[model samples]
Target chain A: MKEAAGRRRQSAAASPCAACKLLRRRCVQGCVFAPHFPAEEPRKFACVHKVFGASNVSKLLQEMAEQHRGDAVRSLVFEADARVRDPVYGCVALISSLHRQIQSLQAQLALSQAHILHLRMRRTAAAHLASGDHITSASASSLSLEVDQTARFY
Target chain B: MKEAAGRRRQSAAASPCAACKLLRRRCVQGCVFAPHFPAEEPRKFACVHKVFGASNVSKLLQEMAEQHRGDAVRSLVFEADARVRDPVYGCVALISSLHRQIQSLQAQLALSQAHILHLRMRRTAAAHLASGDHITSASASSLSLEVDQTARFY
Candidate 1:
């Protein structure tokens, strides 16, 4: 046990994972976060620690699948960075601003669609008027025939 | 001048407008906020004044048209209330949360639309197959007539 503790101390001094380093804990072999969060980028874990705290992060990582851990860590880091920068709203502010943009876009889209529908209706009405004028101009002898044709067309 | 001063003193003593009272200023006859922000509802102006400051609110009301002032004041009061509750995020947090809801709703709407389109396409395909079976069962003697009818229908 003493030899194992000495070896762990040597390993911890050499290269502790960011999470362990930030929390000032000894990083054991096959640590859960070691693969995803390396010892090189200390700031990543710092941000996450500040926002979510180390214990909650540990529980979260433990609950998640191994394959999904990397993505989860990435999301946490991003959210933490946002939280550090904007303590009040964090990522929520960005989402809100984006939502406002989408609303304005939707309104514009509705207006444009209405305008297109109006134009199509006007075009159809004009075409009908023009066809009616042609029928009116036709000989009186063919008036009944023209009317039947117009009725069929409609 | 003395008479005018006495009259002003009498009016000021009667009941100062909320904005002037909160800001510790004399409410003159032509005070801009007097008509909208009465002394009775001092809390409304208090919240607005705390969040936006009396000077900024005054400037904003002065710049806007009379028709828009009511809406501006309402918005200010609401924002101020939110700010008092959450000094960090304030109104921005509400905006951000609302934005998230909008995004989720939009995603749901898009998914529903896509599902509808998929269902419509499947129904159309099924209808086409059913019509094809009918065409195949029709008598061979009426094949040309059927073809002509189908062409016209198309």
Candidate 2:
């Protein structure tokens, strides 16, 4: 255990994390920023650091439970990257965009429902006509949209 | 403008913004935290500061244009509040929920689409029968689901 700790300390000192590299500081052992902000992805730490300073990020990580720190860091990094790309809207913009997509999909569902109803009505009229019932074109077009719910689903 | 600034300074000193009040510091003239983190809503700034220190929040707001600062502040406040409530997922949870809703909506749309196609095929079979094509019940009931896409739409 002591040997492993010693090696980690030495490695941490030699290869600082992205946060420490950006701030020009040595990454000490058990750094709150080290695990989340790896040295390979320097831009991740840069954006997070620019949005939320290292001191504050450090404090936040220290405050949260170890299990949740990864999720928290991911959320922070995503928000930070969004903030940099869009200074005004950020993550909220994506939320609204998703909302718009949902709205459009709902509209499509409604249209499909109406089309289905019309087709069902036409099929009913065709069945009646084929069964020797005298049905005019005008009457067929005026067939009701409402039908037996059980049969409509099939 | 100078008179207005002076009045703001006096009011700020007396009322001190939420950020300053929480930190037990004076709300100085042109404090970035004043406008968005009003004194009436101290919890807003409290959460934001706890997650991403007041200094970092202030810096983030200052870096953005004055016109966009309000929106940026709103986003920060929402993210901070969500973070406090959900230490792990935060706003990402809401994003995932929206995605789930979209998925369900898509499923509904697909079902409706299939229903429409089935209805169209039944109507085509009924039309052939009504025209005295001598189609039996089994033949009519086993109508092909595939039909002209343009005709299926209606």
Candidate 3:
């Protein structure tokens, strides 16, 4: 144990951590040694590292997907340096980007919803205005056969 | 103009900003006065003046809200000199705090989402193993009820 400690002292193993490894520095030991982190480290670093863990990349990705909608990917890339190379960084980065893409799709869905609502509102207004005619030529012209294509997503 | 520039050099009353007004200090013109800023004395004054112009408070509030979920507030407050009672510094500090608070909330929300997913996965595994009629019994439990609640959110 003494000899191993001496070796560890002489040369810290290159931590696979993307941030520490990218910087080519000794790993101050990864998240295990990072208890001084979330509990005691000042608010800024604590908040960042608490959500982002070395061994817990899957959790981080899950959080990114469910909450920030993929903003975490850009942050993860920025967080990585020479000393940190956990392959999970790449996986999570991909996940974050995918999450962002999903969010973009969601935004599109929302706009489409609002548009449909608007069309319904207009139909109601038109019906109020016209006592007899159920189908107006102006409204019929606005209706696109594209509804069949878009409806597949629902 | 030269005499006025020399004589009017920053009176206690004509000081550039509201912060300077309260602090009773000279508004040392910052980067906003240089190459990007206008050269004429009135225009030079306008640069700093613009910052405190119409809707400044609302703009500051918006910026604060954007950063409210992050540590920006604490850091900004820490940067302010406690010795001074300047509104400029106070406003900046307050906005920073708001930003930090927003970030902390965002992080917490993200964590909650990840935890919900984890719980869902756990229940799914448990359900898969629970045989036959026992599945109905397990489904009646609180964990399954929580899953039903979570399902509504997604």
Best candidate (score: lDDT) = 2
Off by over 4 Å in 3: A1-78, A81-85, A88-115, A118-130, A144-153, B1-154
Compared with the true structure, what per-residue lDDT tens digits does model 2 show for residues B1-154? Answer: 9999999987666888888889999778798888888888878888888776777777778887888898888887887788789877777788889999999999889778877766766666656755778767776445532554434544
In candidate 1, how many Å is residue A97 off? 1.2
lDDT of each residue in A1-154, candidate 3, tens digit only: 9999988756534323333343344546433222222222234233223323333333344333344423333333233321033222312333345556556655555545544544445445544555565656766555443444345445
Candidate 1 chain A weakest ten by summed lDDT: A113-122
lDDT string for model 1 (A7-72, tens) is 988866668899888778888887877887788898988876765567656766776677877766
User: What does candidate 3 score on TM?
Assistant: 0.21
Which is the better candidate, 1 or 3, if ranked by lDDT?
Answer: 1
lDDT of 3 at B7: 70
1 against 3, candidate with superior DockQ: 1
Tens digit per residue, CA lDDT, model 3, B66-138: 4331232222222222202332232333334555655655554544554445454554654456433345565
Candidate No. with top DockQ: 2
- The reply for model 1, stretches above 4 Å from the true place, is A1-14, A133-154, B1-154
Q: Which residue pairs overlap in candidate 2's backbone?
A: none
Query: DockQ score of candidate 1?
Result: 0.03
Question: How well is each residue in A80-114 modelled by candidate 2, as lDDT tens digits?
Answer: 88878986677878888999999999978877887
